[model samples]
Target chain A: MKAVGEESASQELQRVVGAGRRADWVMASIGLAILIVAMGTLISVFADLIHSGWPRLTDPDFYTNFPSRRASDAGILSAWVGTSLVMLVTIVIVIPLGVAGGVYLEEYAPHNWISDFIEVNVSNLAGVPSIIYGLLALGLFVYTFGMGQTVLVAGLVLALLTLPVIIVATREAIRSIPQELREAAFALGADKWQTVRLYILPAARPGILTGAIVGLARAIGETAPVITIGALTFIAFLPPAPLQSDFPYLNFEWLNAPFTVMPIQMFNWVSRPQAEFQVNAAAAGVVLMIMTLAMNGLAIYVRFRLRGRVQ
Target chain B: MTSVDAVTEDPLLVRGRIQPSAEFLTHRRLADRLARVLLAAAAAVSVLVTTGIVYVLISESAGFFAHVPLKEFLTDTEWTPVFENARYGMLPLLAGTVTIAGIALLIAVPAGLALAVYLSEYAHVTVRETIKPLLELIEGVPTVVYGYFALLFVTPLLQRIIPGLPGFNMLSPGVVMGIAILPYTASLSEDAMRAVPKALREGGYALGFSRFRVATRVVIPAALSGISAAFVLGMSRAVGETMVVAIAAGQNANFTFNPLEGAATITAYIVQISMGDLPYGSIAYQSVFAVGLVLFIMTFLFNVAGFYLRRRFREVY
Candidate 1:
């Protein structure tokens, strides 16, 4: 009877071991499958982009001048400049507002329903689809504010779209700072404002900058919202300076000028019937991809550097 | 005699009674007041941006309702704003949006969950570090790149596999969108899974459970709320995707159930209309807002649902 009981116990152990091995195999297989799918998509995208864009890459004119009516003369210079100006303006507009809002929420604001409600809505706004921002821009900037399709209006709309992301990221960065640092400053007789300005701001700067850059990158890729604001599809001219062109110097006209962006230009190119234009679109994709990737890389580097320094 | 001498010496101290200067006090008060005012102004900006969005959407949508009846706009089958005679049907666009979102979720949820599981449960530290950055690389690729890929590669591949596939159809674009949002779902789900306490896993392991069993039965169940939130958010992103659908999925706003056929999403429709010259204040112009209102409502609902689910079912442990 003792021998039989021991035999049964060992058999049960074997059964459990068998089940465990089977589960491991299953999970490993699933993981392999997912990795394959993801890598396959990435590889194919690069392959296609190279295949389409390789032929036209040697064209010196591709990077030199603005697109013209003739297909052969078309380049992305104007669109690139326009995208840069709009992005720069968007960064300038969103960073201060977003950082301040984040500072208020994380460092100063009393914990209450009002702050909580704002936090909730801000998170919601982050998820509120980029196209909806376009609609908002159309109504507010174009019709109500009567700013028309100028670069300033486009920049403001993109700024609004990115505000929530910047705010959220900045809040996280600020919250991650050890409370002891703030307390230590306070113990040294530093006021709340002084502590935030001197110590907290410096400590949080890397993270805050990462968030702002990422938000700017997102705005750079955005096409739907800017398009809806009526950024000109075929602007051959450079965008006028915001202060000198639009406000008092230019009589505050809303419908004075038109604008275009890289994504919109690519869209226009892709929609055309010509195969060469499709190739140009792919090349533009490569450029836009590089720009966004550079920003993301910088952000990741900053985050890591900051984490190391803090440690 | 000593006490009398000390009292006489205190006369100098009595003559030296001093206070903080009035300018110093006023400057301090002014600084405090300025800080308060600045904070108030910042708070007001947040409120204004938020309220401004709702007001704009509502007002434009109200203009739309003035021209078209609510029932017809909601239930109509066709969406051709550029037609010689336009119909303001929003159903087709909504259906297209839902169809693509459904396909995208089908692709994203399972693969993303698997990636999350691998990273959280099975991957070595080095592997996790490498894979995490790779996943972020995927996330960082611009939507336009994905659009171009969908248009130039995926659609052609689909055409080869499935004969007579439209150059611009829902399936290719939807699949591309899934790839685009997969990192978001995976990263968030991985964070959620990691949040599940190590003690629970140890307890399961002590009971002789396998890592797979522990992960699936213990960790995943523990992080179900966050995983669900990630899934919902991914769906919202898929629905909101514009460039992919715009480039690969044609701007034919017909209410078709077939994935192989061209369909127009609400976003694609807005892009299509806005890119061209639709006369201002015409019915075609109002249709953009009408469609925008619908898109806004759908995304808002998803966002709210995702928020509540993440909050309500979030486990402290």
Candidate 2:
């Protein structure tokens, strides 16, 4: 009778375990399906954009002409130029400031209320909607600084949106460097500056680059802040070329010139009731996505390499 | 270590300063002090950004409040700022925001958590490595691209199944926003789950639990604080998401929760007024700031709460 009871208990355990395995199979597949759905959406978007946007690409002028009322005449000249210029401006501002801020928090700042204040407020700033950044630029840059709605203002706004991302990323990278590396440098009588300059920055390079690339991608794709700063929705004209016809060939006037970006241009096109404009928007999207994917690929590669080494 | 110590103990070097010249040392000290000040200034920029955002939103919105009673902005149901008789009701936009954002969270939280479970618990290392970057690549995709996908692909597909679904319904954008935010949810949750020590899973297994039970009942509970952090961050993202909702969820400020209808969120409303030819200092222009202030506060609270949860419940190994 005791042996029979033991056998029945064994059977019960088998039954429960089998049920769990079945549940696991179901749950795991469900998880995979979710991933596939994500990939499916991405693949479908790529295919759809290419299918619709490919025809426009054959016309080299598609990359050269300014926005026109007629879809047949429209190209992305002003839009692309504005985007590149704004990115350049953003890069100049964000990298040094973001890296410095990150370094201070990670390596130098004390673990006190002031450091805590900066960290918490930075996260909060990161969470503020892109549009609110636009509002700040509007009030601060456009009105107070008297910059008007120019490329510089838009660039500044995007930089603010990306600063928190870079700071957090930099800190994470700096944190991952084993403490022993720093201790060794200190033991050799290296000052804090020498230790950071000689070892810390070099070690954190890959992580910092990954962060900058990701942040740059974000700044490129932003729309709301640029819009809030009152970037022209319709710009048939390009900003004056830095290489100008005048004696001072490097023009500074374009810094304050009104601008439009790729996403904003796409937005304006999509808003038009014309069926043709929809195709143009699709084409513009393909271009925008290509830029984003390129940046993302570089960042992913950097992170992948870093993980292999750092971990 | 001995070679370095022997060099340090050399009679001339041991007595001398670390650097060659006193002038150089003074210069170096000045540079170090300068560097610290610069770093501090750089760090302060973030604080300034927050203060600037708050100040700008409040100052502009205060003008809006002075024009329209605060009670009316809160209680009224209409949001027809551009109509012949402009009514400044905040609810319609909010209703639309809540509906799309709610739908987005509903879809994202479950799928993202399950995906996190798979990556952390079940998948092989190779599989995890291959899929992880691809998943995060979705996060890097521009919101505007998601917007177009929703409007162009998902909306048409949904309309085919739901016969009377509006062209610009909340459903399509809602789902697409979930897809857009999937990385944030899944990545955070995966990190949290992976943080649960191996011994805990072994403990569950030693008790005769299967991998599934070990993950769901034992592991997830251990990482609840982190998972909650993910949930809050996801909510914040859903609320602030602008492009997809603006493009696919219609420009009309509909005061309904039905997923089949077109509606405008606060972000969408900002897009609408900005696109129009609103003269500077116009009431409509200021109203967008008012709307933005609302969006700002909502996201701010969620983010701080999420941050606190992460700090509070983070399990140390």
Candidate 3:
């Protein structure tokens, strides 16, 4: 009877172990299925965009001509140009401001309540909806400051939007540099600015670049804030030339000119009832997606290759 | 010993050699101080942004409320601000936002958590590294593109299966938005789960626990705080999302809980008004700010809650 009981107990143990192994296999498969489903969605979206937009995407005229009532004649010249100018302004404003802010927070600020408060504010700002930034722009830039619905206002809005991203990235990059580097610089009698400028900035440059690209990629696609500030949907004329024939070769007139970005142009097309407009929207989306994905891919590559060198 | 004693005896020479000139030192010190001040001011821009957001929302909302009572704005079900018989109630938009976000969470929570678990536990390092960036690429795709996908692709597909589904129903956008937000939740939760020490997993296995059992019972519980933070942040993201809903969900402010019907969200409403030419300071214009204030408050509360959860339940280990 004792032998029989022991044999049954052994069998019971084997059965439980078998069940656990089966369960593990089931969960693993389920996880893979979820992953496949997610990837499948991404692939299908790309394929669909390509399928719909191939003709227009191939057309050279699609890149050069102004938007027209005729779907076949319509193009994204003004939209792409506006997006480029806005991005240029945004990059100019954000790099210095975001880098300085990040450097201060990570390297200079004392570990006190004021610093903590500023840190908190940065994180909170990151979570604020992109549209609310639009509202803020509509009120503050467009109304109170009276910047109007120009390229500058669009630039400023996107700059503010991109600020938190770059700052966070800058801080992370700075933080990842080993403490010994800072100590060594200090030991050599380098002051704070000298240490940061000489030792830290070069090491952290790749990471900062990655952050800037990511931030600008995000900013380029933003439509709500630009829309809220009253970007024209039907502007056939381009902003004035940046280079003048007169004494001041560089013109500021483009900054004050109204604009339309790629996404907004896409939005305009998508909203139209015509089937051909949908094709245009898809074509524009494909272009925008390429730009965004390329930037993100580059950023990832930079981080992957450079992250090890710092540590 | 004789050389050291001679050097120590020449106090004036030692002082002159050790210390730089006051003029040079003063210039360097002033430059450093100025840089510090400038950088500090740069950091303060974030604070200024927050102040600007708050002040703008409040001041504009105050103007809106002066004309329309607060009671109607909250309690009323209608939200036709541009109509001749303009009703300022925002409940329908709120309902639409909640319903879509709820559907989004339902899809994202399970899928995202599963992805997190798989990445943290099952994926090889190479696989994780390769897949993560691609997954983030899903997020890096503009929301506007997602909106187009919802309206052009998902809606058409859904119509064949769900009879009587409107062209601009909430279900498609909500689902796509879930997909859009999935990468965020998955990556963040994976980060949390990966932070859980390996010793804990080994201990579980030593106790005769299966891999699945260890992951579900031991690892998840240990990483609960971080996973919860990810969920809250994802939730906030879903609520704040504008483009997806505005494009796919119809602009009609219908007060319905069902996902089959079309409805306008708070974000969609803002976009609709902003697209048209509404002069500044008009009640119609101020109304957008009023809705924006509501949006700001909702997202603000969620962010604060997320922050609190991260801090409050943070484990030292």
Worst 10 residues of 2 chain B by lDDT: B1-10
Q: What is the lDDT of candidate 3?
A: 0.89
Sequence-dependent TM-score of model 2:
0.95
**lDDT (Cα, 0-100) at A30 in candidate 3:** 85
Give residue B15's error in model 3 in angstroms: 20
- By DockQ, the best candidate is 2
Candidate 1 chain B, run of 10 with poorest lDDT: B1-10
In Å, candidate 1's interface RMSD is 7.5
* For model 3 chain B, the run of ten residues with the poorest summed lDDT: B1-10
How far is A178's C-alpha from truth in model 2 (Å)? 1.1
Question: Against the true two-chain complex, what DockQ does each candidate achieve?
Answer: 0.41, 0.58, 0.52
After superposition, the stretches of candidate 1 with alpha carbons farther than 4 Å from their true spots are A1-7, A240-257, B1-29, B313-315
RMSD of each: 7.0, 3.3, 4.9
Compute each candidate's TM-score over C-alphas: 0.91, 0.95, 0.95
Candidate 1 residue B132 C-alpha distance from true site, Å: 2.2
Collision pairs in model 3: none
The CA lDDT of each predicted structure is 0.81, 0.87, 0.89
Deviation (Å) of B271 in candidate 2 = 0.6
The parts of candidate 2 lying over 4 Å away from their true place are A1-7, A244-249, A306-311, B1-19, B315-317
Which CAPRI quality tier does the interface of model 3 achieve? medium
Per residue, candidate 2 scores C-alpha lDDT tens digits across A245-300 of: 77977887778899999999988887777878888888999999899989989999
